[model samples]
Target: MSDLRRRALAGGKTVSRKARSKPESGLSSGNHTPNGSPGNSRAGSRANSRPGSRYASEDEYASESENDDIMTISTNSVSGEDDPGNTWAERLQDRVAELQDRKRSSVQGREATLGAYNHLLKHHFAQRQLDKSVAELMPILLRGIRNGSSDEERLRTLQAFTLTVLTCSPETIFEQALPILKAACQDADAENVKVEAIYALCIAVSYGGGSSTAAEETLDFFLEIIESDGQSVGAPDSGAVVTAALQAWAFVASHMEDLTVQSEAAIEAFIEQLDSSDPDVQTSAGVNIALLFEAAREYEEETGESFDMQYNQHRIMTRMAEIVRDSSKSVSKKGRRHLRSNFSSIVTSLERGKGPGYSTAGRAGPNPHTGGPRTDEQGEFREFGYRERIRIYNQFLLINTWSLHSRAELLKTLLGGGFGIHYLENPIVKDILGSADVEYIPNAKSRK
Candidate 1:
C-alpha cells in the first residue's frame, strides 16, 4: 500500500519510523493528513515521536479512541478548474448560444440541438424551475414547435410549453404562450401539437384581457379541426381537443356578449358533436347547450323577446322521461331527480293554451279539447278544463306564497276564480289548503 493510504488507515496515530523514512512518497510530504489539511502534520509527527506510539498495542489504541478515523472527502471534485465568478445564468446562455450556432451549421446538428432544447424544456417544466431567462427561452421553445423535425418532438415540446405556461405568471404566459398556441392550431401537420396548444390557449383565456380574442381564435381553430378531412374518417377522438374547446366555449358563453360575431359554423360544429359517441364529448356538448339556453333566457327576460330554443322540447322531455325510467339503477336515480326537478317548466310551456289545432300541426294532431271553442253554458259558468285547472293549481302550490302575503292573496283569487278551483275537489288544492290551513270552497263567490 502507498504511504498516504497506510497513514490514513492508521486512524490519526503517529506515523511509524518506517513510514517517515519514505520522504519521497506523497504521504510524507507533510500535507497528507487524513483530513486533507497540512496543519495536522505537527500533531501527527508528535504522536509518532512517542516511544510506544509507533508500536502501540491495537487494544490500547482502540480503548483510547472514541471513533474510527474515517476520511470525509467531498464527493464534488473540481476538474480543470474554470472561473468561479461565472454565474449559472451566464453558463446556460453560453451553452444555449453554442447549440444555436451548431444548429445553424447543419441539418443534423439542428435536429440534435433541437432535441436538447426540448429535453431542457421538459426538465424545467417538470422541475417547475422558471427564471427570468426562461422568458427569453419561450420564443425558442415556440420555434421548436414550428420547426421540429418530427411530430413526436413537436408534441413533447408543445406539452412542456403548455405545462410551463400554466405554471408561469399570467402575464408571462399570456405574452409568450398565446401566439405559439395560435400558430400551432393553424398548422395541419401538427395535429397532436394542437392538443397542448389549445389547452394552453384556454388557460390564457382564463387570465382575462385579450381572453375573448384568444377564445374566438381557439374556437375557430377547433371548428376547423372538427370539420377537417382528417376528422372525417371518425369524429375527433382527442380528449384534450374536446376539453379545450369545451372550456373555451364555457368561458366565452359566460363572458362574451357578441355571440353573433362568433362564427355560426363553430356553433353548428359543436351542435353536431352533441351526437358524438364519446360520452365526455356528449356531456360537454350538453353543458354548452344548456349554457346557450340560459344565456338566451336571460336575454329574453332582459329584452322581452323570444329566443329560438332550436331543440325539440318534446323530444327532450321524452328522452328525460326515458332516462328517468331507465333500468340502470344509477341512471334512474339521477335521471328521475333531474326530470322531476325540471319537468314542471317543460310541462307548463306545453300546456299553455294555444290556437286551435296548434299542438296537432306538427304531430299526430291537436287534442280535441286543447283549443276548441267553449260551450255557451261552460262560458257562462267561467270554468277551466280539468287538466288546465290542475296545471294552474300546481303552479300556485310551488310558489313561496307564505312569505309574500299579496302574492298569496293574488294566487288564491286566480285559483278560486280563473282556475275554477272554487268548485273543484282537487287533491293538489286540498294539499295546499291543508298545508296553509286555509279553507277553500269550490263554488265560493270572489270576496274582493
Candidate 2:
C-alpha cells in the first residue's frame, strides 16, 4: 500500500512538470507560468488584471490617465482663484455680484452682459451647460417679480427666462423651469411682469408643459381683474389690463381644444362687451365673436356636426337687417349695405339648395308709375301688379340680382314682347325715365 501511494504522487508531479514545460500559446489556460514568453506573460498579466484593467497598456487607459492628470491640474489651479475658504453659497454671492457689476456699467456693456447671461441661461436650461445659471436665475426672476422692478428690466429678464424655458427640451424645462413660470404668474406685481409672465406661460405651454392648466389660471386671473370693482378706477390703466386679458384669451383660445367649455363665463363676458358704448371695445368684441364663429364653422365642417344646431341664424340676420334699417346710428348705411350684400348671397345659396333656404332677393320690385320702387311709403308692398312685376324684373336685371337667374327665361313673358330700350324709360315712369331711346320704340317714326 505504501509503494502504490508513492507511485501515484510521482505520476501527478510528472504530469504537472510536463504541463509547465510545454510552450505557452498566449491563450488563457487555468494555470500560468512566470517567464513563459513575452506574449504569454502579457496575456497572463491581462487575465490577472482588475475589472478596469488598470495594468493594461491600451491607448484608452493612456488617454484617460492624461485627461485625469489635466483635470487634477485644472482643479488645483482654479481652487484658489476665488477664496479657498469661501462656501459654495459665498461663491454664488460673489458671482452674482460680478454679474450685477457688469450690468451697472455703460449701456453697451450692460447689454453685452445681459446677452451673455441669456446665453448661459439658455445653455443651462438646455442641459448643455449644466451649471449654476439655472439655479441662480430662478431667484433673480422671483426677486424681480416680488419687488416690482422697472418695466424694461422686468421685461428683459422675463423675456430671457421665457426664451430659455421655451427653447429647452420638454423634460428639462418641465422639471426645472415650470415651477418658476408658475411662481412668476402667481407672484408678479408689475403689470408688465404679469403680462410677460402670462406670455412666458403661454410659450411654455406651447412647448408642452402644463399649458392647459396654466392657460386656465391665467384666464381666471384676467377675469378677476376684469370683474373687480377697482376696474372702474381711472388710475390703474384698466384699458391695459383689459387688453392683456384679451390677448391672453386669444392665446388660450388658440391652444385649447374646447376653449368655450373651459371659458364659457369669460366668453359670455366678452359677448356682453359687444354692446359697450366704446366703439373700440365693441369692435374688439365683434372681431373675437367672429373669430369664434369662424372656428366653430370650421370645426363643424371637419367633424360633420353643428356646434349649435338649434342656434337662431334668423335672429342674427334680422338683427343685422334692423341695424341697417335703423338709419339713426353712425354705421347705419354701412350696416345696411353689408346686410343687403350678405342677405343677397344667402338668398342665392339657399335658392341653389346648398344652405338653409330663405329668399328675400326680389322683396324690392319696381312700380308701374315709378318704374323702380319709389323711395317713399307707397312703394312698400307685400306683393306687386303685372306692370310693377315687369319693372321689378328690369330692376333685378340692372342689379344683376342673384336667386333670379331664371329671370332671363321669363323676360318675354313679363314684357309681352322682347324688351326694348324704350321700356327702360317711359314718360309715365316717375323714376328711370330720363334719356329715352327713340330708335327702339315702335312709335319712334310717328313721334319724329
Query: Top TM-score: which candidate number?
Result: 1
Model number with the top lDDT: 1
Over 4 Å off, model 1: 1-131, 169-183, 186-191, 205-214, 227-244, 257-267, 300-309, 312-314, 317-448
**What tens-digit string does per-residue lDDT give for candidate 2 at 1-448?**
3322221110111123322322211111343322122112210101111111111111111111232233223323122233334322332233233333433443322222333333223212223332335444445544443443344445545655554443332433544445665566455555555555655655555453555676567556555544441152221433434444444455445545555454446546655554443333333333334435544665677888766523344554354345334524654554434334444333333233222122333355468785877554666644211111122222312212211211221112111111222233221111222222122223323211
Worst 10 residues of 1 by lDDT: 47-56
Q: In model 2, which runs have C-alpha deviations exceeding 4 angstroms?
A: 1-139, 169-190, 226-237, 275-284, 302-305, 309-448
For every candidate structure, what is the RMSD over all alpha carbons to the true structure, in angstroms?
A: 30.3, 34.5
Single out the weakest 10-residue window by summed lDDT for candidate 2. Answer: 42-51
Per-model tally of clashing residue pairs: 6, 0
| Cand. 1 Cα-lDDT | 0.38
TM-score of 2: 0.39
Clashing pairs in 1: 14-48, 360-365, 360-366, 422-442, 422-443, 423-442
For all candidates in order, the CA lDDT equals: 0.38, 0.36
